[model samples]
Target chain A: MTSTPMTARRIRNGLKIPLMLAPALGLVVVLFGGGILVGLGQSLGYFPAIGLNEFTFSNYTTVLTDRNFLISLWLTFRIAAVTTVLSSVLAIAFTLVLREKFAGSKITTFLFQVPLPVPHLVAASGIILLITQSGLIARIATAVGLMDTPADFPALVFDKGGVAIILTFLWKEVPFVGLVILAILQSVGPQYEEQARTLGANARQRFRHVLLPLIMPGVMSTSIIIFAFTFANYEIPLLLGVRFPSTLPVVAFREYQDPDLALRPQAMAISIVLAVVAILLLIAYRRLARSAVK
Target chain B: MTAVSLRHISRRFGDHVAVRDLNLDIESGEMVAFLGPSGCGKTTTLRMITGLIEPSSGDILFDGESVLSTPTERRGAVMVFQKHLLFPTMNVAQNVGFGLKMARVSREETAERVKEILELVDLPGLEDRKAHELSGGQQQRVALARALIVRPKVLLLDEPLANLDANLRITMRHLIRSIQKEMGITAIFVTHDQEEAVMLADRVALMFDGVLQQVGAPDEFFRTPRTTGVARFFRNGNFLRGHRRGSTIHTDVGPIEIVSTSETVEDGPSVLTVRPEEVRLVNEETDQENVVPAVVTSLIYMGSHTQLTVTIGDTPWQIQAPAAFQARNGDTVRLLLPRGHVSIVADDDTATTGSAEATLAEGSAVL
Candidate 1:
């Protein structure tokens, strides 16, 4: 299928538009659509490489019955719940405190929004550098006689407590939530607030009645996304999470990377669990979006 | 007791003066309009009284208490905005009951008060409907209901009808006036529309360039405008330049009688002002002096009346006459200018010449 120059030119120009769109469309299909299908198929135990020819419920039974899997799932839920609640409250408070114009409003707004575009791995590492006990602060403390030695520095990350992971997520997610809410708040013009003030609403009353309801949908939507991301997120958990019976994503990643090919089906089973939770979060997000009339 | 008063009030926005040295006294229950063009500080003045914007200097006293330092919520004022600022999330009842709920009125009282105010604004059974579900006019009614349910000492209306269509605006203007009168609340309406101001306000205060040009009853403001700025806002007024000669004034259009409240000063060229309605359209047989023979160049049919554009001695003038009047485009007619309706004004350009044009400048001269 060759063509004449005139026909070739038309064909070339016509193909260019779809060709330019092909990469993004292919990424969406392969990364999102194909990944879900593959994960679903493997979860049912149809993998030829593992010598499992028929679809079986063994992987799912294993996922549901394992005590370690249950603990990891529970821990992930706790971390996500804490992170979402703390991030939403902190984000809204931070936005309200710096919403009005002041000397540092623009800089503060930019600083809060800047963390949103940064990758999760980068944000996790940044938090680790500051908050980890054996990090820079611990070295300074040891040198300044505040601590006797480096080992005396208390544990913040790399422990089963999961507080460090929650804090890391909050440090990243609170600002992201703030930025999303600030965009909505900027459009919620001061006219409504001013009108409320004249109608005898104090500052707290204005925020509670007028401002909060207007930005609630944005906050809820952002919370759902953050919850989904933190629940199945591999990087933050892998980098800072505990080794034994860690968060769901970290445990699932370890099983997937194991040398035993038989264990890969169980990893797919865990991925399937993550996918279900993420999908439910997505559904909750859609409901929140629909409810965001104001 | 006066309802609202501003003494030596001025507001500046980073060197740009929005309102300057304004002293106004509004009696209790009086509806006054601050009418002017955009950027004339009418809305700014209203907001200052409502405490939405603080004045740079001077004081705002509401019911004899200085509210200058008070926050907007504590000022005992409520303002209805230009657009429907109803809470989209809340239903009509909740939005109306917001202030009461904020003031911590009991839930039972809030519900009863919301019901009563909704009925007062003629939205009797719309307590459960969302604000977005209502029409523009209905939304405005809800906003009014919301404002009045709180029972503030004063109500401020910032061009409340500016967002509605023409017919709705006219209907709402009457409805708002009736509501204000019924509530007997001191309302300060801010508008750039002269017709809206005239129809809604018991007294219209004309403002120009952030300065109050005249404040009086609507009839008085129209009858004798303190300045050309005020006269220009109402409609076409015939401006004839002339110099006073003792008891009478002589001009290019001819001479008319002069009875001034001010004492006689140096005689100079002055402007005599007469509205279009004051110019009588006489038939050929009518005996009237100072009749100018003119040709009607254009005719505008305005429903009940026809506006005639006539050229009288090289100067164009508009004459508003009833639609039943016998007049046509390009018709030659005699228009009489009587001495009773005309007032004199000095040339503001020569005002710096130390009353050089003050002799004939009588009848509320503005210099």
Candidate 2:
């Protein structure tokens, strides 16, 4: 017990902050960071589990040159773009209503926040039950004489446009973004709006100049988070997208489960490309936000 | 510029009356100060003029036309608040030019006018600085420039200098008075500092307990007070309880001469008010109308003047004398209470005493 351990004492005294942070740092460095490194290695065609030991760029070359991959990329971009734009715009409108002092507004605000804790996969299943071709709405329409048969109902899920997937995301995400903007609106509440009204600004001008600019940081932050999450999510699109030209996540996940082991490196290559593109888009948005706030 | 008028204006919040039936006619191109203690309805009246707070029953007219139903933006009346609420996201130039931007003025003209206004407020070359980047005084100057840039017909200032330090408060008072006069803009300001009202306004309107007590020029408040409450508010603290017979007040301190006008009854129980500064310290009882022999009881040394409390018979009187005067406690002295400075007024015991105590309690808390 009297013998000194120099490195442990040094860590306790001199590197106190790093020692305390080791637990969180360990998970990030060992799990996600290590996983990314492994993916990067295998993405160059070095999958040791299947006994292929040579590293090559052939996997990336194969995926990048595929016409089907290009079609999938465009389709995924449109879905994420439409969902995020609609969620953000509708969220601001919802926040404006929530800020009013009408009857039952407090209960309504509480109800709006209820979807925040729900899982995205659960929301997709709910969408399937309600709006798909043979789902509740279609059966009700058939009964109501609006449709002659279940097949006569429009195909919302597993369709080329991916309407059901976007609807699912909107159902969950509008509240998420609305609650963020609502917090900002409540904190700085109407002080600048009152001043603007006295300065000859009409209702529309007050919202455009004062309220919108004041709450922009919150809106931009939530929208970017939603875009990144929806871009990389594989479950909803796989369950609700077309078989041909599926999104990048679903296509990569399909390759991951294939019986042929040679396709393992292709899955890793596609995932690495997806992560890099999401980061690049986020960087562009950060630049846009800086200029807009100024 | 516009002449503003409030006719029979009153506002009630539930059971609490904020501003009672008030009528005031403000001339065109004049500056007026709504002055009172806290909870005195001055600010409520000011906000009513701006149409931000509606009166329960009244007609507010601008340039002889009813503006009670007109929207705040269309009324051409802008308010400068105590907090100097510059938009946090905008730069100095953008904040100053906000009114012009709303009016759809050309960008070049807005920029040019913003620059001119910044110079007028003595804060030039600060166009790009954000609100947090400037000092408090500079931010307030920008607030003034923002309100002035639109050439609004009526300017409403709600305690605009109440948030500043003592020295800056004086500086801003002069700046506001000069700007209001030079631009020939009809302006109304609300403040609790009587000195500020007296210094910056063409006329002072004093309120108490949700009711307007008096409105006149600054000197009129001192010479011709309408009631005892007005006298005590301005700290004209020499009140002698007496019985009035014709023009003289008979009290324990002998007959105090007064120049009673039409404001008081000819023969009745009364109270007389004389300002402390009007009383004089003398070596002997010269031929003065209200000279009295008294013994000094207490004295407080205020720099320019010394307040001496003296007892005549069994009653005490507060009077101010020169700072260098030699006087001690229990010293016999001859005091001259001037005749022309005395006024007989209605007793303030009839006014709400409970509200008066509440006002004093709040004032002490603020101090």
Candidate 3:
């Protein structure tokens, strides 16, 4: 009876397409779906390995109300928001200026894209070495007598404000976003701007009304990726953040590494919350992009 | 009154000259076409007029007022691009009303005029449609409407119909001509199509190699192209090497009577040109002053007319006759080169003169 049904379905829907896509689909569902399910299960306080199998909302309640956890969440949001906004605005302005061909434009473009291939950790360290109190800039300033010593330089790295983390993000992500927007601009061509000019739009009006809307979708998508990466990123904030209030990812890492195994549920709960926030942001981005295109 | 005058306008990019010293005076409410091949400076000239491009040297005047320093947005001369550059983010109504909004026209007045122009372009009730949703012809109509809604003093079209299909091109040609006439706006159309230039413009200015070869009425261009370059560009006449002797010219085909536009034909070689349709085929025994005896070489049946190739001595001539006038190869015939229809272009440059002499030496004619 099973053989007959299988044969009938095979006749109705051919085997070639399904057979070709089965491996990729199976791997994706097994890895992604299975991982999410385990995380969700653990977040609800279900852990059979350590003999605690009861599901409860206690883990979520405790994690959500903790003072340190709340501060970490807020700090993460602030860093990501500031970094995304600054990067997008500066990238757009840079792209606009770079769109015009001029002397040394090729060299400028090459230098702008150089940071893109470098790892985020490398960029974070580079920023530390240049802007820290005893770093290169401070040493140079002290040598030039602008400051009496390296300690006289203002604080930029490892501060409570996460200034170095944000600066590192700006240095790295600005070019990534700018390059995407530039590709769109080049593909869309300059004819539209010329047409707008003939239709009596001034330079500012043309940029606002013509160029901005055309590049918005690319900008929005890249911005969402940047926001999610920075929000959940571990290394940059780990290397540059202060001890008072760390990013959510750093707090989660500390919880996961705790010697007390009962803290596993709390760590999983924090990870689950971070994943939820990311999913919500992705949904919002999709809606925003749809409305923008329409 | 001249609406726009381009006095000795020239544009160069680094070392390459795009447009030479072009002088043209466009009368008020008259439509003039800059006709040329690609890279012949037609578009460059249009851009200069619209102030999108500044000439390397010389000035453009609008009604005797120099507009060399005026920005493109304030020049009051709008252009419809060859490719429909409709803003993909905007709907038809917004695109058409963009200029008015920029000019600070009241919202109510802008909407009213946008509606009026859309109706004029036969695109009513399409105000809400995105530019990407419109068809090619409809997009072009929106572009035209956008340019026209501004009420510009001079309208420029940079090969606007070059992207449309053949049937739509004809319809658009008629529509654009009608709209321009109804508005009485001074317009300049740039096109590479000779037929389009002749059919649509009050006067056709032919360009070759960044220079204006001739500017005259459509029929004037067909009747008498000023130089060998103009004749060659139009592709409507057959060029042959000839020597003018009084009121007649001697060619390899035979002696042909001609009407010389020049006061006196120089003793140097000349280029003779005649339209294919003007080369008449007559009875073998007909007594015509410029008649030549020849044999039918080949015949092509065109829809409206039949094209016949006849050989006289060692030269071949193309003659167009009614499709019903049929003859097979090897049949003897008589051809007449009408005196009034023949044009004698003086060989002014070595390039044209060398090519003309080469064609005569080859013992075959180019159609």
* Strongest candidate by DockQ: 3
Point out the higher-scoring one by lDDT: 1 or 2.
Answer: 2
How do all the candidates rank in terms of lDDT, highest first?
3, 2, 1
- Candidate 3 DockQ, CA atoms: 0.81
Question: Model 2 residue A67 lDDT?
Answer: 90
Candidate 1 docking category?
Answer: medium
| Highest lDDT against the true fold, candidate | 3
Q: Pick the candidate with the highest TM-score.
A: 3
Error of 2 at B174 (Å): 1.4
DockQ for each of the predicted structures, in order?
Answer: 0.74, 0.68, 0.81
Model 2 stretches astray by more than 4 angstroms = A1-23, A134-153, A239-245, B262-266, B281-288, B291-298, B309-318, B324-335, B353-367
Task: Kindly indicate the candidate among 1 and 2 with the higher TM-score.
Answer: 2
What part of the reference interface contacts, as a 0 to 1 fraction, does candidate 2 reproduce?
Answer: 0.68
Clash counts for all predictions: 0, 0, 0
In candidate 1, what are the lDDT values of residues B151-212, reduced to their tens digit? Answer: 87888898999889999888888888888888788888899998888888988888887888
Worst 10 residues of 2 chain A by lDDT: A1-10
Which residue pairs collide in model 2, if any?
none
| TM-score of each predicted structure versus truth | 0.87, 0.89, 0.93
